[model samples]
Target: MGQVGTKDRFELVGTPPDHQEAEFADAVREGLSASPRHVPARFLYDARGSELFEQICTLPEYYPTRAEREILEDRADEIAAAIDREPTLVEFGSGSAEKTRHVIEALIARHGHLRYAPIDISRAALEASADGLLADHPELEMVGVWGEYARGLLTLERVTDSPLLVLWLGSSIGNLTHTEALAFLRDVRERLAPQDRLLIGVDLVKDPAVLEAAYDDAQGVTAAFTLNLIARIARELGGDLRPEDFCYRSRWNPDEERIESHLEVVRAHTAHIPGAKLEVAFEVGDRIHTEYAHKYTPKSFAALAADAGFAVERNWTDGEARFRSCLLAPR
Candidate 1:
């Protein structure tokens, strides 16, 4: 087996607890039991949770997946041609990596041999995706990193001599604050060689109604998905949480150019957390802010890439222009 790099040890950064599972459960109880209800979506992806998300993407209500696929299908050849050399493909938050298969296949067809490094939060998901990729493309070498997205990116090393084409797909970039996004991109830039390229997907600014529907899907799947975080905490940490007490709500914060997910407390309450050894109280109508999905315009997006030391090479958009995939080159 090849040696793993010093910085590539993902366990140290995204420490998911086996021993502290009970404590985490208590944290969940305290969080939900608080006046304003909130739980982070990052915790929603356990083995089963990740499988649920993959199903969510396939649902008709999800536009990001379909739109991204259309753009990739329409432009994979163009994207393939743009790369001057066959490079290792590095993906951040590589979930099922369904769309990535197209790009990876395209690169291998043109380049003959390519290395793949898929960084993800779930070790199970990483191994599953890597195993599938290896079975399909025996020529492609894969190095899987199980780590938090932002932390892992900061710690990634250039292990392969092949030039890199890094991917931050699924508009997962939107999950961060604007400042965090900028700094994260800048970190990516600092890690690359001058000629390396990046292909980023950004959900464009759109109707508030559309944005709201996507997050708060009519089928109630999104709501269930949000509530699962609380359940996960309860199960893992030994906290008593009534999932019905909190409602999943999403609203467009236009001024901030983001969609905010909040878990709202329906009534005043108090709860005891056995694991954390704390008592928490909640006031009626208090809400815990969960996540923010920021939309971006092409101009602002280009400026962000530029600041990150990348020049926008080409832009591809869905027919309705609801989303865009921009190819960028390191400056």
Candidate 2:
């Protein structure tokens, strides 16, 4: 594999070819200028934001992570068995890859050796996790990609020769709107070979109160995470933002079957982002849309997979049925 940053055992592969700064600036400007001012959830993950999100995963109300992990632990053997012999595992948005160890161990037991490709936008997260994963799985070969999902998949086309099993776990796909999710899944299907497979995790529709509580946790960690976007703008884009002037709130939008998180301006304020060359004015009660987590039913998600040219081969769910992990193959 092509290596970028090689440590004792871990190897970083694939260069980041995108101009992230320019892209971020453009996205920020566009979102701010839109009729209903908003920000993309992807921008919420700088180093500190990523750390906060990791903490959020462990919060009592955040059941997605725990539910997904339970399914992986219970059905990892079945998941590994569905893949081809000596398959290469590629994971998208693999933050720390904590839940992936179950699958890795199961694959290793069946094949004796394995190849893993973990892609993430955060170089720090990739580098930090690579060493520990390498130490734990001595019979594994790892390649780390520091980029977003689509770019990393393009790079994987060149690096992996074995049958591919692409993973998009933790219900992170819920962040995308239905249309965007279909488009993205189609892109992924196009990138995969005929024999390639995909294992995706998705959160299921549940009680509105439960959904809302997950995003607005008791410890205020979720609030801190939502407000970190303002801090990031101030630090990276030279924006004048007072984070304390805003409050984070989350509500269940039953009409859309999604949870929406917003940063509500507590008072009138103007924030200027020098990097984007834009200024945004907010009045009291004004809210900027920050994130959306869409919940799906099993039939709805299966239809989505079919639309993307994949046939759902097998699906495993947690005991509570609050989450599901579906294995799919090209139709």
Candidate 3:
């Protein structure tokens, strides 16, 4: 654990991810040993994967990023106005903080002064974005947390006196399973006061074709993003994975009600990682489950939030209703 320091307008707290490589090795061993090979999506966001995702966001079929921005562009001020008390903006998975500028501007405009606390896994990305943001917004001060979301959030009360506006945007919650999401939100609820608010982005249920295309694009960028996970295993962890043997796949699992991302074995292959002590075998039909993006209707999301002890204060959507930005107050 590292102590929070305040020497600059935008300061980074928490320790660097010295344990990530060890965790990745452990995860690879665990995931590959399972019956259906699986890998956690978080591991896919290494430096290269993060860059590819930024490109994925710009794709025509990928609507979450564009949809979220539309809502913020139209209603950010209204969202900001709901919090009468001056509040600090805190974001989880606050990558480049590209789409976040909308809400940041609104908060600064309404409050005259604003503080942003961005929590992320990458210290370099956080610092780079922090510098860029500070340069753009002179009134904005920042406190960055370069580790997990929970650690970043717990430090807020000690760092700033203002009420906290926690932003879990970009449909991040949708990445978790129902049980996981509930438990995660409950943990977050435990850390917040009744007056503190959380704003979340929820992707709405849409046409199956639309969902599938968003993940498996015509240009094959999404495919590269999926392959990068296996590529990462080989590149970083001394795994002998023939990335060419695995092909990217996306499907709408109607029974499960989610879009599934996978790497299907195009040809039978085996991978061995000395670092993780794993030797995984694959057949032509074998699949490596990489990610799941669940879509929610408003009713479904609100019910889940209520169970986690939050009340929906506001819900904003794009023109096509492709996504939702929900404001939640502690119940």
Candidate 4:
């Protein structure tokens, strides 16, 4: 990556350094202390965890990434044309911004110039993506926002003066529960300037076997990605949580219409966290619930947008209808 953007264009916002660490320690302590133990999925994306996830995206069992990419590649021109104004494309959780190049190119091709705002919690990933994108797109102007999605959205309000097209790709919205998603979208709706639109990718409900395999792949890449959290605990929290004592597993929770990931205890052990100043004991059969990916049908998702104070402007799906990207406008 070369020809970095100007200093004023790239700045780290949101949680401060000490506070971020404190929040991580606090979250780990509290989640472990709960009866049904769990860890937040955001913590799973440390540098190595991020790299492993890139590997997971390529796995054949993981259909969402491929399916979503196909949707964008096929309809990006149409998607870009749907915008009523020349809008800056803002992407939430824009890791690597790999698939996003389709949308970026489409916007520039239509409007002749483009501005991109990428928001990410991982500053390193955000910076790297920015460098690669800048080197390639001379017509592109980028203002990188480094932080959580909420703070990043707020940052966009301050940095941008043009209409906005927010990109929430990769079916990442599935990370939130139904209630949380509604609240999350409402928060975004409250922040929108006029002419702003949101394009969000979502995984569609399908066969339980397919959903389960996507999360728990045959090559064990997905397993390694999930277990990287335990590795993170040892590395970052200075915790004596032996990674070998746990194994990764996922299930299709039909009742929830989601895939639930867990790190099942392989052997009974006690873990001591000096950083968090906490200790926990686990039984062999006990599970530490880690994450889930909720699936939705196009109809249900459109209704979801409506409840969240937005109208689904248009919905684009892949040929198999395995995934969809919904363009929305604030009601």
Question: Where does candidate 1 have its weakest 10-residue lDDT segment?
Answer: 1-10
Q: Tell me the TM-score of model 1.
A: 0.87
TM-score of each: 0.87, 0.95, 0.95, 0.95
lDDT for position 90 in model 1:
81
Off by over 4 Å in 1: 1-40, 274-277
Evaluate model 3: give its TM-score: 0.95
Estimate, for each residue in 1-331, the C-alpha lDDT of model 3 and write its tens digit.
Answer: 1223323677677754557788889999999899788998888888888889889999999999999989989998998897889887889999999888888999888888898889887776788787777877778888888777767767666455567789999999978999999999999998878778999999999899999999999999999988999889988789679789999988898877799888999988777899899888788989989999999989999999999999999988899989999999999
Ranking by TM-score: 4, 2, 3, 1
TM-score of 4: 0.95
Error of 4 at 9 (Å): 6.1
The clash numbers for all candidates, in the given order, read 2, 0, 0, 0
**lDDT of the structure predicted as candidate 2:** 0.87
lDDT of 1: 0.76
For residues 154-222, write the lDDT of model 1, one tens digit per residue. 566766576888888888889888788889888888877877888899999998888888888878887
For candidate 4, give the lDDT of residue 102: 95
Estimate the lDDT of model 3: 0.87
Q: Of the candidates numbered 3 and 4, which has the greater TM-score value?
A: 4
What does each candidate score in C-alpha RMSD? 4.6, 2.5, 3.0, 1.7
Q: What range of 10 consecutive residues in model 2 has the weakest lDDT sum?
A: 1-10
Candidate 3 wrong stretches, greater than 4 Å: 1-7, 155-157
